[model samples]
Target: MKALRKIAAQAGVALEEVPEPSAPQGTDVIVEVEAAGICGSDLHVDDWTPGYEFMVPLLPLTLGHEFAGRIVAVGPDVEHVKVGDRVTVMPSAPCNACPACRAGDSEKCQNKQTLGLRRDGGFAPRVTARASGCLPLPDAVDYELAALTEPLGVGATAVRVGGVGQGDRVVVLGPGTIGQALAIFARLSGATDVAVVGFDDAPRLETCRALGFDQVYDLKEPGAMDRLKSDFGGCDVVFEATGKAVSITDGLALLRMEGVFVMAGIHEEDARFPATDFVRRRLQIRASHGARGPEWRRVLAAMAKEPEIFRKMITHRLPLDEAVRGFGLAHERGASKVMILPGQG
Candidate 1:
């Protein structure tokens, strides 16, 4: 099998001929990957960013977690999902004995094993994962869109954490894949006013606008903030999806008193914010991590309800052999969601 791997502690990924994965004992399933999505976390690992030291020990690992595939084999204990099922796996698997997992908060389990980060992932034709993590895809969702379920699940979790509801005003900072997903989920949660802000006039910003976002603002433009304030009054929930520290401060500034701030991006460094302002405003800060089982169900249902919009977010697709080029496109500013067809080429 050909797989894309992070072969060194450097700023690139290499495609190499590797042994095809097989299902081992203990409820594992071997999936023949159809499509995989290049995510922002993959970009961080490709660039060897500061917070990615965790990848050092897992060097030479296959680098994809957002993928959907057909099951070719399963261990003896795997009965719920069978061979030939089309599915997408949750990106992380929790140690069932952990305190968090025991209490049904497996997303916070300290002993969780992440797919692309800790083990071999779906950047190849075949990958092995625990059967417990796989979710069967509905007939309405195809492989390409099924590959997006994990990220959309993350967005749903963020919206749930932020307590977004009918008639609430919402603001999302950054128009990347996660940012777009955040906006979609917020609107689905019945937010009456939704605005997305970005520093660059990237293709993603336009993508958000095309997705019918009420307000899409380029921060570099004059009077952007004034327009935002004028349109939405003040934000009841602010989702900081840009990972940059400046976005945190900007989101705080946009948030109304006692508003909820959801940190939905993965930051590579310590982010600074005004403690006094946070206290004075009585703001609530919630950090959203990866999605769990319940959130995955919600995201899949959303995909079923609105498949066209989800399909529109997929702007680029490449063969697995062109993964290096695909990574380049994903890292570029304008690319929306890049998909790698593993079975092709």
Candidate 2:
């Protein structure tokens, strides 16, 4: 089987022939990956960025985390899921020996192993996944939309963290897939005004507009910041989804007094903001990482209900062989939500 793998600690991923997964072991199941999405983190890893150095020991691993497919085989202990079931796998796996896991609160597992990051994951025709992390997908949710469940769950979780409600004004910094997800869920959460901003991100900003976000801004354009300030200044909530350190201060500027600011991106550098301004405004900063069980359910239900809306996020599709090219496109911000169909070839 050919797989996209991070072969070393240095930059770049390679398309290499690797052995197919063996028979299921313990609670694992064999998933024939139909669709997988290239994420920003994948770009970071491909670029050998700073934050993902933890993956150094896990080099030469298959690279893909957000994916959906049908189960081909299952271990004897896998009772909840079975063969031929369509499902999406949650990439984060908890070590059973961890204290949090022993207490049955796996969500707080201090030593969690992420698929595609800490171990081999779905970027091939088939991959092995734990049955516990598999969520059954509704028949209406096709493989393409199902592949989006993870990132969508991430966005839904951020919206929940921000406590966005009816009539609230929301600003999302960065018009990438995660930023798009933030904008979508904010509207779903009943926020009347939602703005998505991007810096030199024309393609993605246009994507935000196509998704029905009228208030889209390109910080590179003249007076774009002034216009954004006029429309969304002192907004009820502001979300930093750019992963850029400067977005913290930029997003804080749009927040109202006592408004919540959610950090939904994985930053590679420390962010410094004005302490006096933040304190005087009574601002609150909250961090939202991967989604929990509740967010997964909400995102899955939403995707099933309106597959087309979510489908719009996918701008490019490629087979496993062209995955490197797909990564390039995503890295250049020329595409949003590139879906890698491993089964296509």
Candidate number of the best lDDT: 2
Q: Candidate 2 residues 155-259, lDDT tens each?
A: 999999999999999999989989999999999999999999999988888889889998999999999999999999989999999989999988898888999
Residue 35, candidate 2: alpha-carbon lDDT:
97
Worst 10 residues of 2 by lDDT: 51-60
Clashes (backbone N, CA, C under 3 Å), per candidate, total 0, 0
For residues 1-345, what per-residue lDDT tens digits would candidate 1 score against the true structure? 899999989899999999877545779999999999999999999998887787787788998999999999999888899999999988688878899999998667887778888899999999999998899998999999999998888888899999999999999988988998999999999998889989866578888888888589988889987887777655799999899889888888888889999998888778899999999999998999888789899888889888998988888999999999999999888898999999887
lDDT of 1: 0.89
Q: Looking at model 2, how many pairs of residues clash? A: 0
> What TM-score fits each model?
0.95, 0.98
The whole-model lDDT of each prediction reads: 0.89, 0.92
Q: With candidate 1 superimposed using the best TM-score fit, by how many Å does residue 305's alpha carbon deviate from the native?
A: 1.7
